[model samples]
Target: MAESPFAWIDEQARARRRAGLVRTLRPRPADTPLLDLASNDYLGLARHPEITEAAARAARVWGGGATGSRLVTGSTELHAELERELAEFCGFESALVFSSGYAANLAAVTALAPHGSLIVSDAGNHASLIDGCRLARGATQVVAHADPEAVRKALGTHSGPAVVVSDTVFSVDGDAAPLTGLAGVCRESGAGLVVDDAHGLGVLGEGGRGAPHAAGLAGAADVVATVTLSKSFGSQGGAVLGPARVIEHLVNAARTFIFDTGLAPAAAGAALAALRLLRREPERAARARAVATELHTRLTAEGLEAVRPDAAVVSVRAPSPEQAVRWAADCREAGLAVGCFRPPSVPDGISRLRLTARADLTGGQIDRAVRVISEARR
Candidate 1:
């Protein structure tokens, strides 16, 4: 047998093992009992009967898949309705749905800024946004994480059309970006602002309208946002919300939007149901924020280096990547499922335990989660 060109993968795998960075998937049983904090379901709607029913009903009515690209045959009435409600709820003039939030980010970045244009991205942006910057036709400058002055300086260096991209809430540290400051800088420079509100959609603003709306930038001519339906919406897919012109431009120019199939009807239905429920019971947003704050307070009080949460995510730092892996494993062994984030995923190369706070968590659950995490730390 001849050695393949991909033989270096074996060496890479060994290196990963030595660094305790080997990744694997574990299939969870439907009814397995474990305290879960790893998933991005920041709200309880994923399991809600209404949401599930909506998904099932949508699948039954719209069929299993979207059939083809949206322009061809993928668009469903359900998708339109979802987009309409989502736009109105988020206070945007228009919204365009995609297969996932990652796709939405790519569509926004790649489409909005063309050749000779500039894209000033935050250093701590999500991978999707980073990839979008890479794929975009515009030249990209990565500014310091959450530093509005850095953003201003980046924009000042260029005189042409520019767009500023950032995550409303950074994923690794669970710290929030200075949205208001960024918006002000963009406004002053006459640059467009594009926010990926994946973490903020279900935890910020009035009933989770999102970080941009909370910052009073929603529907602003120079502002845009992308959201994930899978997070607080407890569904699947993503959407880009902005002025009508921007969305129209996406429809015509964004390859990710035009080439990718439309979001599934089931996901659209579920997200719509979740949005309506959130509208009816707006306290869910506040509840999720409270849970994150409580988790941060308790963990920090125990002498753990936990970042102060600005939304529903609370991150506790580990000494090293190996320690982070071991700590998460220990927590899982103790009947608690937690998220472990390490190098490459973390731009700062700091490993940590990432936990998402859900709106539906009860007081007892919060205490249990905190105790389990604290006990596993040391």
Candidate 2:
């Protein structure tokens, strides 16, 4: 005869159910017959033999986990090698690897935006960047999505140290940010530009250098980039790429980097293998982009409202949240796996079926996926 301490959580769950916003997890098996368009494996390297083999080799050579923080006993030869190669490949002066992309974002944002600084962030930035802005000591001003003029205005209002943050390619709509324009504005205002290329690496630029490289902003003294190894490299870690001084600053000041353990050796080795593979086969990047364009063209031709993809993600509008969930289920039933986006996930409150184009997806697979999606549309 005692009231539950978590009674409020039950009420919130009931509210979510009534609003059709309740979410649940569905674990996937190692091998499935369904065609996948839901995962972020844009380069289709997650299951590559070389990548996996490297991971296993690393685990054997360097043990399972990082024993301590990077400053303590966590740094390893593999991490150093990955950082050096990643920086060189991405055209940066230096790079620092982190345990995860979220932590990398946090480190970059918090380390760069010191106290009394101003942080101008894009309205449509990823959650990690948003959380970074929230945790940073600087004041945050969210500008319109992909708007350089708004960023300029925001920077103009501030007189001291300022940094503009955004995603290179938005994950939700798959639209690219105006990197050149944002960079120009930042230069004009003497502000630093920080971009999260989580969705751009291995899907844009020559040989998948990234959106910043594509925009000619790579290695700029005032520019910084954060990338995830999990999506494109089929590994599990994140890195911050910028000038050596900035990286050094992060090593000293970024709590996420200084206090957190170094990236696992397995992830570092896998990412290194994937990066070398990408360098050898540069066409993979172009292939992924081509697949995205093809998916968008075919989806629109089939009369579905799909956004024009700038990278490997293709988003198709859905009528409602419930309908979106049902439509995704229907696609699964048809032997296709797709992503479903709804209310809180989509800033605009529009539901969607989000499809990720992979470099390894064949034309036949594309056709089949399109057909399944078309038939499953509500």
Candidate 3:
């Protein structure tokens, strides 16, 4: 009998099962009676009629896909419009859109940190940023989470071209990074700063201009930011915002941008519509933050351990992975959908129930969600 090359997969699966870390996907219906707190639609605009209509109209005009890689044939007028508006909104000198947020991060980090360069990354950065560092030709040193002093010390060790990479708001714990402190360290060391504001885009800053803008680092010569359109924009895509020269560099040198297909027209259109809507209704940003605060306050008041949310994410501590999974299931059964985070996803290896606060959620919805979470806790 021939040896099975796939036999190891079964062993790994068994180990995962024994450790209560098995993951399964559940398909959600388009219309459900459940109150959703698991999705990243912070502004609750994913299903907005205007946004959907924009998507439909774009597909009708652009014919579905982008047709090719950006440089080859994919750059359409809509994409150009999106890039311009996005840059203006975020206060960036220029911007380049990618197929996804992960791709954007990879392009920015790998392109910026070339050979002989030093990349100082925060310990709590998203996996995309970590992978970017791994793929880059530069030497990478991961510092303490949100510790500007650690970054400064690391930068001091290298005299070559350096860049500090971090997330504006950590997704796992929902705590915001000290952007001002990090920016200061980068400036003192003469290193560029790259921040992933995926979580902060539509939830932080004045009118959701973003964390970098709020930190007064927007349009700075040495600052670059990556954001996802999937979250608050209720669309599908990502972009890099920075100086025009850096944007040109990414276009020329970033493998992810050059090799990957362009963003879909529908996504670009929907994102643009969402951005315009957000501009008109800036109060949506504040409402999301308020909802998160309310959820945290109510959860903690119920004697549950929850991290104080800095954006629209609220993370509540769970006793174990199994308990966390069960708790999330219980909440779903109670007509409330929440997110469950476990071992590999959580940097600290602690399990948690992650809930998102949507701007459209009503007072009754918030009260009901908190009650369900409390009752679901083991």
lDDT of 1 by residue, 1-378 (tens): 999999999999999999888889999988767888898999878889999999999999999899888888999999899999999999999999999999999999999889999999999999999999999989999988889999999999999999999999988887888989988999898999999999999789998889988988888889999999999999999999999999999999999889988888889899999999999989999999999999999999999999999999999999999999999999999888899999889999999999989998899988999898888887
**Per-residue accuracy of model 2 over 291-353 as CA lDDT, tens digit each:** 999999999999999999999999999988889989999999999999999988888899999
1 against 3, candidate with superior TM-score: 3
Which stretches of candidate 3 lie above 4 Å from their native place? none
CA lDDT, every prediction? 0.92, 0.95, 0.96
- Rate residue 7 of model 2 by lDDT: 89
Query: Model 3: per-residue lDDT, tens digit, 1-378?
Result: 987999989999999999899999798888999999999999999999999999999999998999999999889999999999999999999999999999999999999999999999999899999999999999999999999999999999999999999999999989999999999999998999999999999888889999998899999999999999999999999999999999999999999999998999999999999999999999999999999999999999999999999899999999999999999999999999999999898989999999999999999999899899988784
Task: Please report the TM-score between candidate 1 and the true structure.
Answer: 0.99
Work out the TM-score per prediction. Answer: 0.99, 0.99, 0.99
Clashing pairs in 1: none
Could you give the candidate ranking by lDDT, starting with the highest? 3, 2, 1
RMSD of each: 0.9, 0.9, 0.7
What's the TM for model 3?
Answer: 0.99
> How many collisions between residues are there in candidate 1?
0
